[model samples]
Target: MPQAFPIFPLLSYDSRKNSMTEARNWADKKTLGGRGHFDLQSSPASLVLDSVRAGDEGLYRCRVDFKKSPTRNARTNLTVIIPPHAPTILTKEEGQPVWTMVGPYNEGESLTLTCQVDGGKPTPRVVWLMNGEVVDEKSETQGPQRVTNTLTLEKLTRSHLHAALVCQASNNNHSTPVQTIINIEMNCEFYVGFSCLKDNKRGMDKF
Candidate 1:
């Protein structure tokens, strides 16, 4: 009868630093000098990260030393993907109001809306959708932590009334995108015998 040896009895891992190896077991979470975020997989010789972060992205090396065979080295890279915060829609001039319904303006009035998102590893892209159709898609990076996109409608028409406007923010395909919505409300007009009539619904007559 023959005895079988285990696969890669002892495996060591390290992150690439300055193009050199620092001689550390990065996959040993319980080790004194280990990063504590990684766990070594014995059977398949893999490294598992418990919770990934932006700083943990880089090239990694695994060294497998066999008692009767030549030592083998393999390298792999890790990339971290961070999801962005929920999108916010700002309409008011002074305060940021998360309005579910905005308007009651004249049909010919213009409109402007701003969408903002914060804290994504690769920066989030913002887009505007009206009634399930893409109206605008543009994003600006304010800094390393914030991104913004603005939508402007030159004139609001009767077709915009009760229309759903959505602002979507996304950074990666793995996670669901964050979004916010607002419904447009236009002035109510009644026509009787070719004469236009306005009703005082929200305190103002004729929008």
Candidate 2:
């Protein structure tokens, strides 16, 4: 959980204290046999990588075949995520969505909209927008999962048909804000017309 005491310029470690010329990799492989220079207690035996860099990552494993009992093996995943850079958002329609079937029914409805982002240092930022407004929630990346956010709206109406909803993903990696636009519409005449009409009526009554 904590960053293994990183003193860089030093990584090899040992359990015993002896006057030896610090060694890097152990040839034994079985136990990475303690050489003369193995750092004793100076650093952690196994490095705890909170976040890995791009260079060397992915699954790292070690296998041991002892002459006595059972064999042993272990693996660890090292993934690199670079933060996306804050890029320009031109007109908010650069990477906008283009609906299929050329229909308007899909425009309004109860919906759960979400956005997913990948690659970033210190993690990319993901935010949801409803009717061009921002929604609040903690943004975190689980494992190699790209940043993602979901916005849920219940019972849709015509006003939300062709409404401008946005999902913004940003980090230091990209030079522009990545946005995905959602244009929702309800196709059912009974649902859109009757429901939307009554919903608006309630608003007027409130005043």
Candidate 3:
């Protein structure tokens, strides 16, 4: 009977640093020390990350170099998932009567709706929607994790009445986003003492 020896392939793992160098070798089975947050294990060859952070999310590549055989390589991506908190909506008006009611506003006025989400890792994306349609808006990042998106409606008309304004916060980790919805209100001048009556009638008609 002949004794058999287990042949192991040399494994090395690298992360992209910049466009010039391609990838910098961060961990290898042969070397030790100065790995920071990266851990390398032998035998089967595996890489372990310790105390992952938001900045650590990126592409990673692993290479297996054999002495006489062809060199083999594999690539993978690492995404850090941090679900954001529930979105909050704030309404602001200039030089006009502010409507605190859920749904009522005067026409020919400008209103600002600010959507905010606080405390999320990897920075969540905030989106604004009007009547289920995506609204073009820019999101601003505050500190490390907070995000704010503002939408301004100019020259408000009765066409906006009963329309739903939604703010949603999402990340890759969450299947469903955290959202808040506000229904536009018709001005009292339009229909005296009939606030939300149309909504109720529409709901009843569905049944």
Score residue 119 of candidate 3 by CA lDDT.
76
lDDT of 2 by residue, 110-161 (tens): 5654455666665677886766678644465755646656566666666665
lDDT of each model, Cα atoms only?
0.74, 0.51, 0.66
* TM-score for candidate 2: 0.40
lDDT rank, highest first?
Answer: 1, 3, 2
Q: Which scores greater on lDDT, model 2 or model 3?
A: 3
Q: Write the per-residue lDDT of candidate 1 for residues 64-132, one digit (tens) a residue.
A: 665568988777777898888888888745437667987777878888878888888788889999999
- If both were scored by TM-score, which would come out higher, candidate 1 or candidate 2? 1
Task: Write one digit per residue (lDDT tens) for candidate 3, span 1-207.
Answer: 532222432233443344424644443334223333323445555666656566556666656655568978676787887678888777654323223234466887766777878977667889899878899457899778689998888988878877888888887654688888888886734554533333575565321
For each predicted model, how many residue pairs clash, with residues at least 3 apart or on different chains? 0, 25, 2
Error of 3 at 85 (Å): 0.3
Q: Which candidate ranks first by TM-score, i.e. highest?
A: 1
Query: lDDT of candidate 1 vs native?
Result: 0.74
Better of 1 and 3 by TM-score: 1
| Candidate 3 lDDT score relative to the true structure | 0.66
Instruction: Write down the TM-score of every candidate.
Output: 0.71, 0.40, 0.50
